[model samples]
Target chain A: MDETIEGSFQIIGGNFANAGEASMQLKSKLVELGIDEAIIRRAAIATFEAEMNVIIYAAAGRLQYYITPHEVTIKIDDMGPGIENIELAMQEGYSTAPDWVREMGWGAGMGLPNMKKNSDEFKIDSVVGEGTTVKMIIHFS
Target chain B: MKLSSIVESISLEVKTGKNNLQNDVTGVYISDLLSDVMANSKEGNIWITLQTHLNIVAVAGLKNLSGIIIVGNRQIQQDVLQKAESEKITVMSTPLPAFEVAGKLYQLLNG
Candidate 1:
């Protein structure tokens, strides 16, 4: 718990088959580190939501995590069309995902809110034509 | 109650993770939305949904759900069943809709 642990995972967009792999890996890593079960669950949920966002919207992305004694930090950086309206995107049940994605039981517009709810601290940055970056921190106490 | 007991009582079809039928059912969560399940489902809860996609397996695994009940006898893909097996998450199908399945499960668990 004293030393810092870090890791990174690649996320391929539109790969529904492999979606949430990064989050799953992160969850396993946290479990291996012997973190608290509740903390691990929150971290896992936040990271999974971020991973899904990249898969559903971006072309590709990287999920990186840093685990310290006090907190677990997750960052997702992707290459895809960014959100035009952060406010609207942050609202619950507001999604721009196409019908195909909706048909697959996703795109309910709860991803961002879920991430924020699970994380002790959350931040999102995006450019209209470029991409989006999401950062979340879960405190371990 | 154990998952195998519920399956037997309800006549649900076992698709995969047959060996995992011994898992103890903590509760039931009915949702087709992946994020909703991710956000709300507790560990050991059984998820009931109409989704047959591979990501359902991922959600079940992430939440550490006891199992998945695919209601309405939805046609689950072969790959989905395989993934569920690998994840060690029991997935069953039933001809009944979500409402009926939920009702039966509620009685068994709370009755």
Candidate 2:
């Protein structure tokens, strides 16, 4: 592997009906590119978590995948009411998602932790009223 | 039993994929939560869900699931059905609720 590729996905906020479209497409593309299964699963899980966060909390966002011979990087940028407490949000089973989202079986607050666990590197930036952006990287061998 | 047999045995009314039964379902998993299913489901299981959303199909695709069966008499969205068809993943709907659908699938798979 001595090459690289990049893909970008636009995540629409409040689009419960159409979410995950981009992530799925990216997974297919990676499969076509012969990306490793572990790396592809990590990328898929990260994208899924990010997409859900954008849909559940943010107004809108964009996701980008940077693939290289050594590793893959994912970035999610969103515009919405940002996290007031980043540390708390990172804790598992802690969620601020409303009743409806919970009723449908999300908001377990596993999104961030799962993203971090599945990725080789993880970083999150947020402000009270600004927004949230998650950057994650997973190395390939 | 074939996937078509599971459908016939359970009396699952497929809103789509009537001809795509050539796809085999080795197992089945039932869940309404998109996130949980994506995380836990083994590949090639027919995912049964009542919460019909476009993400259901995506999760199935990610997990390489045989197909998704929407239960509880819900109407499969046009866009979702189209996506499923395009992806060659079988999509179907059942009037049965989640638990009932699960039981039926179990009986069919065992039968």
Candidate 3:
């Protein structure tokens, strides 16, 4: 186990071309830091889904990564139209994305569920008309 | 199965990452949705999709996929090809739709 390792990244809304960049970067960092490959894949998948949520739904956001010897934690806060129904939003195959977003091979209503599935710990909070934030944690052991 | 053999069997056009033809293919994953692939795809699987975008390359690289085969003869963007080459993610295509291509690949891999 090592000391705490931390980093942050910015995400721009509607930026489909660069949507996965942050997750890729974080995954590379985890690889460089020599974390377990399985754990890193989970974290990377969770982060990518969260990042895509920001791009498709939010106007902008920040993704923060915190790593300790025992676990890896990811925090994402976005400025967008917050979810009105968290339960409905959590359902698989439920999506509000416009047709255009769907055309890009995303907005399948799988993003949030996939994120939750990949995280050892997951929590989300949102305020209608304000914004949304997601936190995901993965154990290193 | 190696990517080259799959391409040869399927008669796919190699779009990029030609140098990576020797990458091993453990199985196949057929999907157009990005998150589903991210969550369910196994490493070394060959991805079959109609999506032609740069993010697919990123996803394939992230998942350590053996290669990507775009179906339906979709016109893949140039930037997507460049990204695949740089990442060494083998990319190929076929005029056949997803089902036919997937069937042929499966037969080649299993038969």
Best by lDDT: 1
Assess candidate 2 and give its TM-score to the true structure.
0.56
Per residue, candidate 3 scores C-alpha lDDT tens digits across A1-141 of 467888888999988889888889889988988988998999999999999999999889999998887888999999999999999889765678875786677876678989999999999999999999999999988
Winner on DockQ between 1 and 2 is: 1
Worst 10 residues of 2 chain A by lDDT: A91-100
Error of 2 at B20 (Å): 53
* Cα lDDT, model 2, residue A32: 81
Count of steric clashes across candidates, in order: 0, 0, 0
Q: Write the per-residue lDDT of candidate 1 for residues A1-141, one digit (tens) a residue.
A: 679889899899999899888888889988998889999999999999999999999999999999988899999999989999999788765677875787686776678989999999999999988899999999988
Clashing pairs in 2: none
Q: What is the lDDT of candidate 1?
A: 0.88
- lDDT (10s digit) by residue, model 1, range B1-111: 888999999999988889988989899999987878989999999999987667889999889999999887566667778888888889999989999999998898998
Off by over 4 Å in 3: B1-111
The CAPRI-style docking tier of model 3 reads incorrect
Winner on DockQ between 2 and 3 is: 3
What CA root-mean-square deviation does each model show from the true structure?
A: 13.9, 14.6, 14.0
DockQ of 1: 0.07
